[model samples]
Structure formats: C-alpha cells, structure tokens
Target: MRNLTVIIPTYNQKDLLERAINSLISKCNDEINIYVLVNNTESNYIVRNKNYANLHVEYLNTNCGFCKAVNYGLRLIKKSRFIFLLNDDTEVINQIDIDNIIHELIEKGNIFSISLKMLKGNYPNLLDDAGDMYTILGWQFKRGNGLPKELYDRPCEIISACGGAAIYNKKILDEIGYFDEDFFAYLEDVDLGLRALMRGYKNLYYPYISVLHVGSATTGGKYNDITIRLTARNSIYVIYKNLPLPLLIINFPFILLGYLIKFIFFAKKGKGKIYISGVLEGLKNLPKFKEKRRENMRKKKISNIKLEWILIKATFEYFHQYIKRAFYTLRGAKK
Candidate 1:
C-alpha cells in the first residue's frame, strides 16, 4: 500500500488549483498519490489539462462542501496509511518531510493528526494558521492567525489540526470516523479532533513543515453570508455532538456568552439576522446531533477533568492572543 495519499479539495478556483498541484509535484515524491477532488466547476477545467503521473482528478457535478469532498476522496483511496488534506488555494512552500511525519505518527501511537504551519502568500513573516484551537465557549479559531510566523514556531498539542493543511493517520480516522458530513463546511475539524480526543488520540502542531496559503480563496474572504451561516450553525453542532449532558451544563453560560459576543460582532457587519437564523437552524436540528453524542459516548476514553482542562487552557490562550493582537494593532496605528 502507498504510505501517503494527498487530497486537495477545490471549488471554482482553476488557476489556483494548478498552482497547488504543481507545487506538490515539484516538492513531493512522485510515488505519492495526489487526488484533486474538484467540486462544482466548469466541465473541462481539470479534464482538459494533461494529468501527471501520480495525480488523479475526481470531478463532481454538484458543489459538495468541504466535508463531502474530502470524504469522497477518502473513500477512493482507503488503503493509504497516512492521508494529507491540502487546500487548493495553498502552495507547498518546501519539500514535505514525509519520512519525518510518518516517523512521528509511528513513534507516537496516540497522535491522530499533525498540522503544517501555513504562512500567508508572499509574506513569510505573516501566519495563515499554526493550527486550530477550541475553547470552552464553543468557539473554534485558528491559532496564530495573522501573527508573526515566528511566534508559533514551537511544536505543541492543538485542539484540532486545521483541515486545510493537515496530515491524518488513516487508521485512526477509520476507527473514530471521517469528517462529519452534516457539518457541510465549517467547524467539522473541531468535531473530528474532539472525537479523536474522546478515543485518547492527540492532534498535534508540527512547525517544521509549512505551506503558503491564500486564506478564504474559495468561500469569499472570511465574513461572507455562507461562511457566517455555516460557522454559526456548526458551533452549536460541535457542542451538541461532543459534550455530554453534564459537561454541556457546565459550559453553557460561557458558550452562551460566546454566541452573544459573536452576534453583536456580526450585527455590526450587517449579518445579525443571518447569524440568528443559523443559530435557530442549529437548534432546530438538535435531535440529530444529540443522537450523535450518544453514539460517541461509548468510545469516550479521556477523563472529564483532562477534557475540561484542555478547554480551559485553550480559552485562556485565546484571550491572551486576543489581547496581544489588539496591542499589536494599536502599536501599528501609532506608528
């Protein structure tokens, strides 16, 4: 079996997709299989181009969101030991240390995944993401977003590896589950990571490997209606699917506060109504996510104390970075 299979999910960005594929072809070993899972795009965009040796394209007629696109690729290449999920808008900036990543996965039996540090395109000092972070408040955020790239150089355990550019141990993923298709687009990685934790597996941040990312190239720069709706709704899905009833009660107030803060923030952006609709949509679908929680309960391996502490640490770090980012913005303004 091939040791690694790379899946790049794309939606309507033909030129950028070419760049991402070429970057991998140049940097990665030709033996590694690369799957370009093309989501709703023109008929001949990918087909017209001459395919490379180890690269394959899977074309879809409908616009399946991130979760389904990735899941489809997983189904196609199920035997690979490690799977790397890369975003079409990203370019591999260095040779992927496949041996090191595989060694780490093998040496550390509990690690489910590893995130690659991503810097903003053309600005090596600016970070796209170090990893994904989750807090007790039901918030999932990108660690070290827009901060100096050097600030997040150390390796550490993260709440989740950003699905955009992370490597997963296919065996563990098969055991826990693939990305939840109900998520459709957002917060799905957090749900997957939480599930991994429940099964006593770690998700890590490995800073030695990196990529150049053009963030939000597919979903329209961060705050669009589509992203807002999906993120708002999926936040509730995350809390519902992972946290048991007791834990949910303990975190309720903080989670509510988080939602309120986000509501006001979106209100300022004229998306308040849209955000509320999304929340209502999530609440409406509670029964399904609750069932999912019950199904996952039997697999819970990590103790309650450790889980809570992980969230508490993430919450404090979130606020710490928030304050530091504000300070940096103020300093920049003064200059």
Candidate 2:
C-alpha cells in the first residue's frame, strides 16, 4: 500500500499539468503514486508517462468543478494513508520538502493536514501562501500571502491548508468527511478545516515544505465572476455548516459586516452583482447545510468558547496585518 498519493486535478492546462507531473516524477520517489484527475478534458492530451510507473489518470467528461473532482478522486483511493492535493499549476520545488511533510504527518497523528508553503511562480522570492487563515468576520485569507518568502520560515498551526498544495491525513479525512460538494469550488477547504477543528484535529503550516504555484490557472484570474460568485456563496456555506445556532447568532453581526465590506469592495470592481447573487444563492440553499450543521455539532470535541476564541484571535491577527499593510503603503507613498 502506498503511504502517500498525490492527486492533481486539472481543467484544461495540459502543459501545466504535464510540467507538474514531470516535476514530481523527477523529484519524488517512484513508489509515490501520482493520480491525475483530468476534469472535463480528454485523457489523450496527457502524453504517456513511460518513465513513471505509478502514474494514473482519470478523465471526466463534464466539468464537475473543483470540489466534486477532488471528492471523486478521494473516493477512489482506498489504500493511501495520506492524500496530497496539488494544483496542476504548481511544481514541487524539492523532494526534501515533501519528505519533511511526510515525516511530520507520520509523527503527528492528531494533525489533520499540513499546508505546504508556495512560492509565486517565476518569482521564487515572493510568497504565494504560507497557509490559510479564517476570522470570525467570515473572512478567509492566506497567512503569508504576497510577503517575502524568507519571512515565513517556521512551522505553525493554521486554520486550513490551501487546497492548492497540502497533505491531508487520510484517517482524519475519513473521520471528518471529505470536501463538501455543495461548495462546487471555493471555500470548501476552509469548511473541511473547520470540521477538523471542531473534531479536535489540528491543521498546520510547514513553511519548509514549499512549491512553486502559478495561481488560478483554471478559473481565470482571481476576482472573475465565477470566482466571486462561488467564493461569496461558499463563504456562507462554511459559516452555516460549521457554526452552531448560538454561535452563529453571536457572530452574525461581524459576518454581516464582513459581507458588507466584501460587497463594497467587489462593487468597486464591478462584481457586486455576482457577489450578491452568490450570497443569495447560498441563503436559498441554507436548508441543504442543516445536516452538516447537525453533524458538526454532534462531533464537536472542542468547547464552544474555545472555538469562539480561535476565531476572535484570528480576527485580531487579520486586523493587525491590515493595519501593517496600510502603514507600509502610506510610508511608501511618502517615499
């Protein structure tokens, strides 16, 4: 049985997918199987991997989107102890980084996932993401996004692993369930992380384990109508699915404020309508999340107060970063 299996989900970037696969084949051991989920694409596009023995490809005729594609791939894997979700637009930087992540996973049974650090493609000095962070204000952001790569050199706990490149323990995933298909794409990883947290499992960021990621190769550039709609809609889904009744009511105002701010931001970018539509859609389908809410509530091992504290702390961290950025921007303007 394979100890680790890397799942790469691709939409139409055949070249990028091949590059990713080749990078892994060269850097990783031949024993590590690579499963490529070609979403809405022909399998013939991928050139035969004669050199790599453990490569597998699954072709989907319809565009099932990211969540469903990943879950579909997950369901097929019965032997792997760990599942590494990687984007087609990313390349493994070094085998040692992956080895470190595997070692960490083997050492820690309570860890649900390890989010590998990503350097922006072609700009190796700039950080793409360290890990994912969530706030009570219903905002999810990358922990070390757009910062210097050198700034984040330590491992730490995170709210979620960025789905682009992360290693998840199969056991924890089995216990907490896979990505919520209702999300279709956005914020689904955050929902998974919240479920793990509620079940007393820790998600981590290991900065030493890094990848080179060309962000958003499939969904167009970030802030497109599709991204805006799915993100807006899925944010609501995450909030609804994870929070219990009383906590939801308590955090309602902050969440509303977050949405309001996001609406204004996107409105300035001419995506306000798309954002509102997503939110409305999410609200319309709120009933669909009822079972998820009950499930999380039932399996919740962490105290309500602790969960609130986690969100509150993450919120404070967000504000601190916001203020720091604003200060630096002003300083640069003066310069």
Off by over 4 Å in 2: 42-44, 97-100, 327-335
Q: For residue 63, what is the lDDT in candidate 1? A: 93
- TM-score for each prediction? 0.96, 0.94
Candidate 1 residue-wise lDDT, 1-335, digit = tens = 28899999889898888888888777874468889888888655753336566778898878989999999999998679999999989988888768777886545668899999999986777888988988988898888887888899899999899998999999988888899999999889989999998879999999988899987888898899988999899888888888867788999999999999999999999999999999999999888776678878877988888888999999999999888788877988899
Estimate every model's Cα lDDT from 0 to 1.
0.87, 0.85
* Candidate 1 error regions (>4 Å): 47-51
Model 1 vs. true fold: TM? 0.96
Whole-model alpha-carbon lDDT for candidate 2: 0.85
Clashing pairs in 1: none
Worst 10 residues of 2 by lDDT: 97-106
**Clash count per candidate:** 0, 0
Q: What is every candidate's alpha-carbon RMSD to the true fold?
A: 1.6, 1.9
